[model samples]
Target chain A: MILIGEDLNVMSGEISRVIKEREPGPIQQCVAAQTKNGMDYLDVNVGPVKKDPEGTMEWLINTVQEVTDLPLCLDTTNPLAMEAGLKFCKSKALLNSASGATESMETMLPLAAKYSADVVLSVINDAGLPSDADERAASIMESAAVANELGIANENIWVDPVLLPIGVDQRQVTSYLEFIQMLQDLLPGAKSTCGLSNLSYGAPKELKSLLNRTFLVMIGRYGQHSAIVSGFDRELIRLIRGEVPEMVELIYRAMDEENMDISALPQKELEYVKTVQVLMGKSLYSHSWLEV
Target chain B: MMKYEPPLEKISVNIRETVVGHGEKALKIGGENTLPFHFFEGSLPNPPGLALEILDTEPENWAPSVLEPFEDVVSDPVKWAKKCVEVFGAEMLCLRLLSADPMGKNGSAEEAAEITKIVADAVDVPLIVWGTDMEEKDAQVLTQVARACSGKNLLLAPLVKGNYEEIAKAAMEHGHAIVAQASMDANLTKELNIALCKFFPPEKIVIDPTASALGYGLEYTFSIIEEIKQFGLADKDKMMQMPILCDFGGDCWRTKEAKENREQGILWEAITGITFILAGANLLILRHPEALKLIKEMVV
Candidate 1:
């Protein structure tokens, strides 16, 4: 999987402070550490740190290039800031991101074409996040059509199904997995990504790690090619280090604590789910493995 | 309809270009930006090379098919090495120190070094000095050969998990390249490379993922080579970025099919060599002269 390092983003208070202070030490350190941890690309998001988002983005790109040569994922809400980073990048950057939103398409597509950069286009427009899988697939296809017309090659596109916080709407989890599978059918060669941490927004720290790693592996079977994630997260790292585990112990733990339903799993996997249910004395409660 | 372009991986890690036998005799390999022969997508900077195999001592119990070709020079290492390059048009020559095996002649390290030096001096092309499959004897023999041909830059072999540190140190202390070997496991191949890189540079290493014959796990060998290439091209895995050397001829000639029929023997070797080439092997160490000729013609 192509892993984009997410630690450099200004989402954290410490990183925001470092960017605000114009300290190259922390940012460069983060880039080195993440690259060592096996990040294919580093996501650089100078999020609202200063009046000049473009200048700050440029500084971030330049500072990062000084330390290492790994490709940068130029991330920003502002298209101009993204372009500013792209313009200064020594190598091609993965543009993160565009959406079905007209303004995003109008700005990001031209930059992607002009720079010959790969782009991440989310499957959400002014119509807002799709409530179902088909709606999400349609939004992604529409955005891809625009990108295709703009001459951005299909291989250079990453389609994100816009993962929602499961805590807010539990139903979005099923839709997210389904949409990832639908992405390949809709946009043949286009890659798919997920910001894995979004799945556990309201969950506790340990539970959040479990949720993100398990969900990443599940979506992987559905054609998700990459994930924007913390490489240092042991659970996420463990998955990338080798093939997915035959069974994730976290699933049994979640059922034990949160009483989460796992019937969404296919037949073969459901057998294990049923075993866990029986072992936990939950549904179709039966004798434990130790009993007989 | 738009042409369905496969997503060619943007290779981030470069396979270090290695030059063997410095100056006029130097042959370059690696530095490919794409999978082997996917010239439409990216460049294959160098053509896969062929190293004709020659043994240091005569074969008393050799396969009749292979033994027939070198029947005249079977007794002499220097003459056998010369016949490969001067007569057969071999791009490189590999001198296998078979007599150094503890179970065989139990030849001293000094004797192996002497013959290696003789082969090195005789060949205008580069030389690959391979050790016996025996571990402890290989360490002793290869250490002597590395020191004897110190600056000749001969490609030494059989750097397994057991003798890696010893031979790796010798290759580094002397100026020779080492072939890191593993048995059909891509991860183990990378692990050996990574481990060797701690002492010897990655550029100075060639991966030998233990070649398999045509009827004997060739598909498994193909997948391992493809995985090594994909990791380099797709994930830019630095440890997997080195050129691969498949010693398929050794395994191909030893199969029961080869022992039964001479025609089947040549076909087995040819198909195994071609399969590995397509699967991204940069060097093929071959036995049959006809298979070598066929591959040279096919690849060009």
Candidate 2:
């Protein structure tokens, strides 16, 4: 997996403070930590900077680039900020998103093309998030067409099906998984990524890690190219690196609905089995799903 | 006149760049994101590296044409290694420990280690210490060689299924790289890599899918190489993403046509080397200096 580190973001209080004060210490420290933790790229997310978006993005890009050379995923809603970040990137950058929504298509895609950066094509439109896999596929196809018109090739466009909180909408989780499977057929050379933590947004803190890890295996099995993931999670990195074959094998069996005596499994393996079941909607999801 | 625009698709994942040797002259290979020499599509950060092969003991049953270049220093592995670097302009050398074969001279692991240390010290370029195909002997010989040249970053070759564990561990502990050899089968190649990555860093591993002479299963080798590259770059299969190494010199020289003729042998080796380059070989091992020169000219 191409791991984009989710630690360097304005949403975190420490990162926000560093961004506001223009202090290079905390920012560079975070960059070093993520790089050491096997993150392939670091996400510079100054969230929807309504004030001084350009100056803030330029400062963030310069500060982060000073410490490391891993590619940056410029994550923000403001196109002006996105452009500012893209301009200052020393290596190739990923434009965190452009969507089927006209406003985003009109602005972000062109900047991605002009800067020769890869882009995240979120499956969304003016009608908001798609209801099912087919609708999500259609929305992405529309956005991809516009990107192609702007001279961006299919391989440069990474499609995200807008993973929703599984706790809030269980059905959409399956839809996105289905959309990931449909991606290569729909856009042959395009890649896939997701904000992995979104699946665990409404879950308890203790259960969030399990949900994220389980869903990563699920999506990766379906050929998802990359994910915006927690840089500090060593076990999650191990799973991504294919170090835990037993865990991955157990999850695959659960997905395949293989007949195995659940009683024979160890405690940790049983938890993964339950998590896979919950993600697949074979069992109901609740805070106490693991207990059940 | 109508202009033609080639249909080009860039691969998303790059084969991991692996470094061998250390410091100023260390060679790096396999960071390309496209098919080899497909510069129109993606970057080839480093060209394919070429290395000349030398035996730890005087070679036996060798082709006269291929032997002529190194006949003077063939008895001394140290001088032979220096000749490859200083005279032949070889950037890398693969020292095959043929004497350690239990079926042959049955040399001791310590003897192989001592000779390897001397040759490695004699040459400034990186060295690839290839073991005899005997698994038990290789496990013993390569482990000693790896530890003897500690921190030299020599690439230990032919770490097959039966012997990878002991050798890979020693290579990791001693800060050396490894070449995982699989028969010309894509699944076997991926399986060996997946197994090796459990204990070793994937970037320190290279794949040798068992190269063959031009008419001797070369097409089969080519297809397997192409498949490995596709799985790595297109399918983004991490296990198949390491740089490929082809050591076909021994196979090419031992052929009937190559053994009888001189120019035919050089072209056979050069053509085989060039074919592997086109099929995505990141490093090649050739025996003749003339063949290496021919391939190097084409590579540049």
Candidate 3:
């Protein structure tokens, strides 16, 4: 999994406050924390809170660059702010989105091409999120064609099927997974990605990581190229890699049924899960903290 | 010209970095994103540790070539172990309880523990107490040895399927680690890991997929380690994430190449150790100092 840190957006009050005050302290700390956690790229979203979106984007980019050299994922609907971030980015930036909408393609595609940046293209047109995999595939192909015409290489294009909150309509997961599978086959050279947490929106905050990680494992098997996720989720990446035997059972359960009843899992898998928990509970060693 | 980068997905699961021994003697291993020494894309956090083997009982049946390097210390394991650490710069010592084998002396567990306590007290370096392949004897002997040297954090060996529970409980109780051994099958290796983890912490587990000699089924061992590494990193199989061990000294020294001549024997051991290092073995056990010296140079 290519983990893109989702922390630097203005949606977080602390980040918004720092951005508004032009405070570099919290901004630097956020970048440092995420990079230390192994962020491949950090998403910089100067949301609608910034009265001066363009300047805020530049400040965020510059502030982050001072501490780490991780590529910035320039995230904004505002083309001017996106370009400002691109201008300030010290390395190749991933343009956080382009959509099938005429205005989006006309402005965002050219900037992505001009800057030689990878672009995340959502399959949403004026009609909004596609209702089915076929519609999603059609929309992605259309936007991808525009990107191709602009000299933006297909491999550099990351297509998102625009996830809907699964808690709202549990069936959305089937559609989403199908759409990803379709994108892999139909969109030959383009890569696939998702804002992993978006699928868990409207769910209880505590259960969000579980939902996102479970869904991530599914998409990972379907071959998601990358994901914009909480980079600090060591367990999530571990689960995605199928490393944790206990969490791996969650994947097996999720695959077994739509409702995913753990109690109903086969005897062998349930026994395996129990064994993992028992092993994890034991302390392996004791070390004195005073010694370096 | 535009080139196609093969979209080789980089492994997201960082191999859990763990240290053996404590303070200055601690050796860190297994923190790579790519396979061993693929430093351009990943990091090899620590070099593979080398341990010199010392036996509890003298080997009268040993090939003369295998015995040449240990001519001085072969009679006294304590002296042999000390020479390996003080004279040869061995980072660790592997105390093989060969006398406890049913076909050999079949010594009681208490006797092995007595010898283990002596070695443990004498050496400041970490110890790897390897057992006879006999499961019942290993379980009995290792239990006593682990309890005798409770806090030393020695790496105990050959935790086979039938005896893992008995041995692992002892390991957890005494704060030592166990080398979970499996046949050349990756699935069997994972099963043993999953089974041992039922009673032991994953951090205290090291894997041994049953080392093979250079000319005899080394490829099978190679494929198994490769699959194990892929599962640990690519699939994020936590049970499979433990560092791998190559018990090279016994297998290499027992081969036909060792029977032929001294140089061929040393070369055989060196080649086997180097092959395992490249194939992702984190702890390599060897008998000859020459093979150890050559392997150390190639490992880094």
Candidate 4:
């Protein structure tokens, strides 16, 4: 898995303070940590920089570039900020997102083409988030067509099916998995990524890590290309990097519904089995599913 | 005249840059994000490394032409290694422990390690310690070599499915890189790499999908190499992202056509080397110095 470091996002208290105060120390430290932790890219998310968007993005890009050379994912709603960040990037940058919504497609796709940068196409439209896998595919294809017409190659368009919290709607989790399974056929040559932590948003802090790691393995089994992931998650990184093949294999076997005695599994393996069942909607979503 | 624009997609990840040996003379291979020699589209930070092959014992069946260049030093592995690096201008040397073959001399692991130490100490360039394909013997000999040459950062070859665990563990414990050899099948190559990466770091692993000689399954080897590169760069499969190594000199020299004439032998090796280079080989091991010179001049 190609890990885009999510630790530098403006949503975090320290990261937001560093971006707002223009402090290079914290940003560079974060970059070093991510680089050492084996991140392929680092996300520079200055959320919707409403005030001095251009200046904030330019400062953030320059500060981060000073420390590491890993490509930055320019993540923000503001197109002006996105362009500013793209201009200063020493390497190819990923435009965090555009959607099927006209305003987003019109503003973001052209910048992606002009700059020759990869752009993430979120599967949402003016009607808002898609209700099912088919709806999500329609949104991605419509936006991808616009991107292709504007000269962005299909390979550069990373489609995000918009992972929602399983606790809120268990069926949508299945829809996202179905969409990923259909991604290669639906939009040939395009890549896929997701904000992985979004799937655990409503879960308890103690359970978020398990949720994120389990879903990552599930999506990876379906050929999800990459994911925005926490840089500090060593076990998660290990699992994705093929360091823990037995664990990944167990998850795959569970996903395949291979005949196995659940009683024979160890405690950790049983948790994974249960997590896979919940994610696959074989069992009901509950806060205590692992306990059950 | 028509203006032509090249169609290119920016590769997201580079094949990891791996440094072998130590110091200023250390060799760096891989790190190119684009396909081999596609300089118009992407950067090739390091050119492919070239290593000349040397045998731990007197070579038994080497053709006359291949042996002519190193006739004086053939009996002495250390002297032969020095000749390749100092005289032929080889940037790297691969010491093949053929003496350790169970059917051959069946050289002891301690003896193999002693010889490896002498050659590794003699050559300033990076050294690769290769073993006979007998997995049990290779595991024993290579582990000893890895221990004796600790911190030399030597590249070990032919870590196939049968003995990858023992050898890879020793390589990691001793701080060395490994060449994970698979048959001429892309899926097997990937499976071996994935298995190796479970314990070893991916940066220290190189893929050898088993090169075949020209006119003898060369196309199969070529297709497999191309497929591995495409899966690595286009599909971005991490398991297939290691630099590829093609040790085709032995296969090439053993061919009937190569033995027919000296010039044909040189051309045979040169053609095989360059073919794999074009198909995305990051490290090549060739026997004839002239063929190495010809390939370097042609591709570099």
Candidate 3 scores an fnat of 0.00
Candidate 1 TM-score over all chains jointly: 0.53
Model 3 chain B: lowest-lDDT 10 consecutive positions:
B14-23
Candidate 3 residue pairs in backbone clash: A241-B235, A241-B236, A242-B235, A242-B236, A243-B236, A243-B237, A243-B238
User: Per-residue lDDT tens digits of candidate 3, residues B158-210?
Assistant: 89989999989998898887798987766567667777766688888889998
Error of 1 at B117 (Å): 0.7
Off-target runs (Cα >4 Å) in candidate 4 are A1-292, B1-6
- In the range B124-216, model 1's lDDT, one tens digit per residue, is 899888999888999999999989988888899989989999988888888988899988866467656766776688898888988787877
Enumerate the candidates' DockQ scores in order.
0.01, 0.01, 0.01, 0.01
Kindly provide the TM-score of model 3 when superposed on the true structure, using C-alpha atoms.
0.53
Highest lDDT, which number?
2
lDDT of 3 at B151: 83
User: For candidate 4, lDDT tens digit of each residue in B51-168?
Assistant: 9999999998888989999999999998898899889999999999988889989989999999999988887899888998899999999999999999999999889989999999
Give the poorly placed runs of model 1, Cα more than 4 Å off: A1-292, B1-12
lDDT of 4 at B175: 95
Candidate 4 lDDT tens digits, A1-292: 7899999887889888877887799889989999999999998888889999878878888899888989989899999999999999999999999989999999999999999999999999999999999999888888888888999988999998999888777779999999999999988889999999888887768888888998999899888999999999998898899998999999999999999899999999998998898798765555656654
